[model samples]
Target: MIVITAPTGNIGRHLLPLLLESAPAHGEELRVVVRDPARLPDAVRARVEVVTGSHGDAGVVDRAFEGADAVFWLVPPDATLAPDDAYLGFTRPAAKALAVHGVGHVVAVSALGRGTPVADRAGLVTASLAMDDLLAGTGAAYRALASPSFFENLLEEADSIRENGVFTDVVDGDRRAPLVAVADLAAVAAGLLLDRSWTGTDSVPVLGPQDLSPHDLARIMTEQFGRPVHYARQPLDELYTTLVGHGLHEAFVQGIVDMKRAKDEGLDAGATRTPDTATPTTFAQWCARTLKPAVLS
Candidate 1:
């Protein structure tokens, strides 16, 4: 059986078809770990056995990872102060469960630039590095797929674009950071599950499409949408207050601002390892293909 965590998330949702097609024959099982089985979509619920419980619970993970050959691991996103600290509290238990269960292979979803000091302020990278290290010690064939910041980040601005004719982020409207599609990340994770050649702890970077700045994103939006798209750049505190007003914590806002600072300092910019094999859909293409239509309606 192949078990996956966060199966209702962006990449997990997109990964379903490929996984179903690739499962081993003679009733190779595909199971998902979810806090509540009833919340899963009908299609995913019908296709796989839903392992009910939080990934954080050892008791839940013991059952979730039981009989599982490979596992796709991910922690829930946190928008709080010292996210990395919070993650250790969350991921440590799950890591123990996987170790106890003797899961054969693990494909963890991590972010790029995990270990650098600059990553300390960036929530996902800091937390994921800890996760990678802990999981590595488990002796399972572990692969920490470190993907670039996702194109899905654009979704957070969907409401602003639809209502105010603009989009906003901490990014300096013109600086480029490698941004990838979740589908690409999922494909790489699935490939690792199928091909268990690598051993110990390893990382696969998924930098999809090329680097793009908010200005470039705006231009793409203008072109694809056939409307004058604009950028809204806010001061760090302003952004923090705005997000806090939306129910996120100030610490979470600070982490986001710190990420933009990291971007400004060239933290996210990196040398590409290989020409990407995954569908390298540009932001414009993604808009034309997915986002534009959804928002227009």
Candidate 2:
């Protein structure tokens, strides 16, 4: 049996269908831990066993991990908590359940910059790495999908781009870094979950086909949308203030600020994009398929 957590989330929503298509051929039974079973399609609900509750809940993971051979783990972001509590704390219950149930393999969504100079101080990224450590300590064969920011993150700026021809980020307009589509990340997770021959804890960098700067994204968005889209750099202080003012925890707000600072300092630049690390989707393709539709809608 293979178990998936947060099955209704961005990554899990994609990962679930891939597994449903492939796992049955491998003689694998699929299970999902979700807060709301209704969020799953009627067809999906018929195919998999559903354990309803927050995966962060000890009882929920205990029930979900039982008789499971591998798990696709993705923590939903919680802006109400500190970075450590948001990542490691949320996983602690599931980590314990994994060992107790003797589930052998786990593939988790994580960030880039594990060994880089800025990693220890990169706030949320640092917490995500620590969560990797906690899961590895459970003796499961773990692969953290070490990823940079997602192309889907731009979806948040759809309204801004539609109205003002602009999108915003804390990174410098010219600073380049790898970015992956969430679908690509989900595909990577599905691959690892299905093929569990690999052992030991390690990270797989899921960099997209090329590195892109904010300006490059703007140029591509302009081309894709047939509009004069532009990149706007937001101040780190302003981001923190805005997030906190929106009622997020102060520590979590600081964590976002620190992560943006680290990324600006080349934290995500540590990984080399080999064929193994590079994923297939290009930024332009993502803009055409995902962003343009979002902005135009």
Candidate 3:
């Protein structure tokens, strides 16, 4: 049996079908822990066993992990919570459940920067790494899908890009960093969850075809949309102020500010792309295929 959490999320939504399609050949039964079973597509609900409750709840995860062999773990972000509570606190229950259930393997969505200089101070990245440590301590063969900034993150600004031909971030406009598509990340996770050949704990960096800065993204956006798109670097203080104004906790807001600072300092700059690390999608390809459609819609 294979278990999945956050099945309605960006990566989970894409991953469900792939796992279901491959289940026959792999001889795996799929289960998911969802806050709302109704959010699951009718097809998915019909195929997989569902434990209806927040995965962070100990009772929910304990029930979901029963007789499960492999699990896909993802902590849904909550900006109103502290960094520790959002990452480690939420993961502790699942960690305990994994050990208790003796699950064979675990695949988790994490961030890159484990060995970087700024990793200790990288806020969310730091917390994610710590979460991995907690899971690794459980003795389940764990693979942390270490990804950089996701291409899907741009969708959050699709409307602004469509209206003003601009997108904003706190990172330096010219600092190139790895950007990956969530679909590629999900595909990789599905492949890992199905096969039990691998053992031990490791971080698998899922990088895009190439590294590109915000400025480069803007150039690609301009070409793709046939309009002059631009990149705007928001001041860190201003970004923090805005996040706070939106009712985010100060600790959570600071964590984001620190993460952006780390990125600007080249936190995700160390990973060298290889056949294994490099995924197939490129910024230009994603922009044309995904972002354009999102903007148009």
Candidate 4:
């Protein structure tokens, strides 16, 4: 049996069908832990065993992990919570459950920059890596999908881009970093969950086809939309102020600010993408297929 967390999320929604399609051939029992089973598609709800509750709840995790061999784990983001509570606090219970139940494999969504100088200070990344450490200590075969920024993150700014031909971030417009599509990350996760031969803990860096700067993304958006889209570097202070105004926890806000600063300083530039790490989708392809449509809508 395989347990999936956050089944209605960006990656989980895409991953569910792949797992369901392959489960019969693999002879695998599939389970999903979700806050709202109603959010799951009818097809998914009909197919899998549902454990309705937050995965962070110890009772929910214990119930879901029963006889499970592999699990897809992802901690959903909650800006109102502290980093420790949001990531580590949520993961510790599940880690204990994995160890107790002896789950064979755990494929978790994590971030890159593990061994870098900025890693210790890269707020969200730091918490995520720490969560990986907690899971690794459980002795389950753990693969932390060490991903960079998601291409889908740009979608949040789609309206701004459509109306003003500009998108904003705290990083330098010319600083290139690895960016992966959530679909590609889901593909990697589903593949790992399906195969049980792998053991031990490791970090799988899911880099995109190429490194891209915000300027490159802007260029892609311009071409895709047939408009002169541009990248705007928001001042860190302004970003912090806006986040605070949105009622985000101060620590979480600071962590995001630090993460953006780390990116500006080339935190994600150290890793070289190889055939194994390079996901098939490129920024241009994503812009045309995903971003352009969202902007137009």
* lDDT (10s digit) by residue, model 1, range 1-297: 888888878888777667888876435689998887886778768889887888877788888888788898888776654565556777777778777888889998876775555777665466667778888888688888877678778877787887887987666887887888788788888778776777877777787767788898888899888888799887777876777888876666666677667766666665464674334767777888777976676
lDDT of 2 by residue, 128-216 (tens): 99999999999889999999999999899999999999999999999999999999998988889888899998999999999999999
Highest lDDT, which number?
2
**What is the per-residue lDDT of model 3 for residues 40-111, given as tens digits with 9 covering 90 to 100?**
989889999999999999999999998999999999999989898999999999999999999989999999
For candidate 3, report its TM-score.
0.98
Model 4: residues with Cα > 4 Å off, grouped in runs: none
Worst 10 residues of 2 by lDDT: 186-195
Across 24-108, the per-residue lDDT of candidate 4 in tens digits comes to: 8999989999999999888778899999999999999999998999999999998988888889999989999999999889999
Against the reference, the lDDT scores of all candidates come to 0.76, 0.94, 0.93, 0.92
- Candidate 4 lDDT score relative to the true structure: 0.92
Q: Please identify which of the two predictions, 3 or 4, would achieve the higher lDDT against the true structure.
A: 3
Badly placed stretches (over 4 Å) of model 3 are none
TM-score of candidate 4 to 2 decimals:
0.98
**Top candidate when judged by TM-score against the true structure:** 2
Alpha-carbon deviation at 64 in model 3, angstroms = 0.6
User: Which 10-residue window in model 1 sums to the lowest lDDT?
Assistant: 270-279
